[model samples]
Target: MEKFTLELLFHIIGIGAASGLIYKDNSLFVIGDNSGFLYEYHIDSQDLKRHPLIENPSENILKKEKPDFEALTHFQDSLYIFGSGSTPKRNAMVEFDLAQKKKTDTKNLTNLYEVMQNFSSIKPEDFNIEGVIFEGENWYFFNRGNGISNKNTLFKLHAKKLDQEFSMTSIDYKLPKIKGVRTSFTDAVLVDNKIYFLATAEDTQSTYHDGEVLGSIIGRIDIETMKIDFTKKISDSHKFEGLTVYKNDNKTIELLLCEDKDTEILETTIYKLSLNLK
Candidate 1:
């Protein structure tokens, strides 16, 4: 098996400040860290469009601060958007209605947030969340913690029948320590029978605030066992916050990643990663 290769494909001003990516309706949707709209692009064309805010005040409790949505995924034709829950923004999820072209249900996830919060080792103000994937009829949520926050947890919850109620069980996850900056999982996708994760580290004291862009890489874990398998370093000092994994031509593994450098008005970058699974 050969290693995967990543290449910088495109750069856009103010558009690629992405925190999450999702593929639906034959297009790719990228969500920014602080924005209320979703950036939609056709798969093989340059046509890009902006979708309305997934969270509307009428359907949602008016939040004082803009909700920093981080992770996005879909299941059974329904699209889901989740907030980072690392800040004063309350934990929340919005379900999109395709027929109505708007958000249908916006639910508060206080219980699920409290569960993950109590499992943290850092101060209550420092906790953060960045990823989620649904596989095997279970929802997996990944939390990214730094040296200051000092905690990282993977949670699994079954949502077959429950609407807003979440009973998350923490899964065992371990990463070899990295020098200089703290590392944690940012985003993930399930490919084949394995779940791949994009782990990143930035020079920050707490996970709640921005830090110097330091490192980014990819790794995978066994779905059946739910344990770490292998990790490969793709960048030592670049920050990639969004990931989309799929197979093209029935033989090649392709990844779309977006970076957020915490810059003021600088264009964010999107990279294309290709590898052979062997």
Candidate 2:
């Protein structure tokens, strides 16, 4: 692996760290899996602001409980945030109209998450998802597999309306595993129409939530050829959860990698990763 400077962007003080990241409107937004609040960071001013998801006022899709927001992305003029559905909760997506900063749509993705959770071979905890990317008219949902029976399943949803009524297709997408190591997809991003993954392996015994951090990697999936490559690996202690492209010069691009400790540290981390992929 080439040496890249891991520049700290923002250490989330108090509350929990971020599970997903999105860069839009000259700002960076991070989501908490335990909390439904979106932490916004201004690039130029370095201002950190917290905003709560406005409850969908309509009783038809009104949810009293805060969904565990896991994935964040931007499409057109709106920002979409998704819940993990780790425990079969009302898996939904909250869409914010960036032009108005108002919750404009509420999508119930329970049918998608519930089917994966209730699969005969996978357990509810093993069916967790953290990686999601919106490209073209399809939304890619990656389940964080524990290397047990699951192989980082990927669900492609053809979204016509950003909500509940979409067709979904699934496939078992596998990442490269170190010797006897079971890895999972933490997050993903699409650059130049190609998909790159933030793959990390933890030393968990498959029956736990958090585990000893082992290895981290930045991988790529050539959608046309349908090939998954583990191009670079990071042997650090950081449990990277989110990834976004920051700078794309002629030669190298800066990858913004965010970390979630999953502990009571009251702080989050973002590292600027530089990769010279020719």
Candidate 3:
């Protein structure tokens, strides 16, 4: 593994609790955990635009009533936003049309989530999903181990088939610990058959509440081997929950990350991380 460096890119005000990020065509698309708006930040112009995803007068929803959208991924012309599935109310998937700039479809993943919980033997209180990866016909959901179960697992299923009879493949991963605190999956992206993920170590063991963050790490898993290739601590202060590849080449890989400060502040900081591959 090569040494990684971090740099401050910019900040997006009023987009607090930024949880999911995707960058394409020089525009950064972001979704917050507590907000009902999709934000687009243009890199060249430095302009920010917000598109409402729900009917809200204040543009932000109450914390207790929010959908808790924690993961974002796009397929073809639509961007899929998924709830954390920590509670009964957070079991929805919102599909936003990228071209139309509006919501196109919605799905309730309650049955699927319940089945995963049962198969994984994870208690209801410990079943928080924080990340998702959509590649070809497979969909991989990353379940955080922040709760009592402490089982960082990856669930894979056929994306085109959602019937109840379809079986899901469950794979467990033991993330490295930071300062004696176990790290849990936050977000992931698949590139060239390699899966890169972000994991954070928080102080608390409950998935419903926030805790003092110990640190965050970046790791990789090769699809062919299905094993952890490497893991390295990225930050000891910022609790990053969203990750996207900003740029990649033969020598280095640049990633863009969004931080969850666990506060009521109306701003989010975007960081640029560069990893030397040589």
Q: Global lDDT of each model?
A: 0.70, 0.70, 0.87
For candidate 2, lDDT tens digit of each residue in 94-167?
88777776677777777766765555246666676777888658888888876356558777778855544677
The estimated TM-scores of all candidates read: 0.86, 0.85, 0.96
lDDT of 1 by residue, 1-278 (tens): 25778888777554635788876656677777666766777757767766666434221223347577788876766667788777657477777655555667777776667767775443556566788887537888888766464566787887763365656677645554455665788898878778878888777777666677667778878988887888777887777888886445547778888887654353557788886766
As for TM-score, the candidate ahead, 1 or 3, is 3
**lDDT, candidate 3, 108-177, per-residue tens:** 9998999999998888999999999876588889999999879899998876535435657888998989
In candidate 2, stretches whose alpha carbon ends up further than 4 angstroms from where it belongs are 1-5, 10-15, 54-66, 115-123, 162-167, 205-208
On a 0 to 100 scale, what is the lDDT of residue 277 in model 1? Answer: 68
Residue 2 of model 2, lDDT score: 60
lDDT-best of 1 and 3: 3
lDDT score for candidate 2 against the true structure: 0.70
Worst 10 residues of 1 by lDDT: 54-63
After superposition, which runs of candidate 1 have C-alpha atoms over 4 Å from their true positions? 12-16, 54-64, 98-100, 119-123, 147-149, 161-167, 177-179, 248-251, 264-266
